[model samples]
Target: MTTAPTPSRADALIREHRENMTISSWASDAVDELGRLQAAERTLQRLGYQDRGGQEWAPPIGQAPDFDLIDSLRSRIAELEASKNARIHKLEMQALDLASENSILKRQEQAELEVRKPLPLPLPLSDDDRLRLRSDVARAIWDVMREHEDRCGHALEDVEPKHQVWDCADAAIRAMKDKP
Candidate 1:
């Protein structure tokens, strides 16, 4: 046996807003993380660059320790720059993908919203107009059925002539039903 899950207030909001915010949230987080990484990389690159054109540490060796340290720092800075560029490129690609996905979600959300425009309020049907419409509907149904029986060699599905008025009312209802 399993316990039933509890209902939450999020259901109504989800129905209206859907999950579009989730995608934007992920994109925002990615951009923020990339920004922080790039800032750190910039700081490290500056510090390493500051050591350039400096002669320090008096030594009597073939290759001075200061020069070796400078070379190492240069290589480290290069590696850091390369990594930063690669990550920036990755973030750019992610942004493009996210933009495309967000666009598609926006279209889908719009389609999901049943924005019903109030139909031009059905004009009031006066008694004379109603009678005329009823007669017209009855005549139209009778003529169509007679033509089907004569030309198509088949009787109308339920035209027994006993429920003529009822059939006309049904046909009128069907014809005047709401359209999408």
Candidate 2:
């Protein structure tokens, strides 16, 4: 079967109006032609196409352009341009809003992934280090007791201070190893 030929710009404009639809390329071409006509009309109007007595301003005696028709066409073109601009602006705003929403979703997804990740393993301590920590704990407890005895003006009984210190040190080491 033979394919149908493309419609002319004038036919496209008429079809758009009659059916309330757009044929993209053809409609754009028609609009461009309308813009050119409006620009030319504006230039001719500014240059004074007719005299006060309705005679042609230039040497061509009988040809006075129709200013009223040109005015109507210009006004229609302006209306169409304004509508096109408003639609474009609205679409741009919607695209920006969608992009912002997408970014927010991505950040939220990253946060969820971070929450699901596993904790790191703790480092180990050697036997010598463990002994040193226990000794430190015993020294600190002894110093605190001596200071307390001096403040109270008496010597306090040392009841299993070594055992208490060793227990505290072991608890601290266990806590450190258990930490994520």
TM-score on alpha carbons, each prediction = 0.31, 0.34
State the lDDT of candidate 1 residue by residue for 95-151, as single tens digits: 999999999999888866733232332457677776666666666666666776663
Give the number of the best model, judged by lDDT. Answer: 2
Model 1 segments beyond 4 Å from truth? 1-65, 114-180
Candidate 2 has its poorest 10 consecutive residues by lDDT at 151-160
Against the true structure, candidate 2 reaches a TM-score of 0.34
Checking candidate 2 for backbone clashes, the offending pairs are none
Clashing pairs in 1: none
Q: How far does residue 107 in candidate 2 sit from its true spot (Å)?
A: 1.1
**Best model number under TM-score:** 2
Tell me the tens digit of each residue's lDDT in model 2 across 11-55. Answer: 887876866554666788899999997786667666555344444
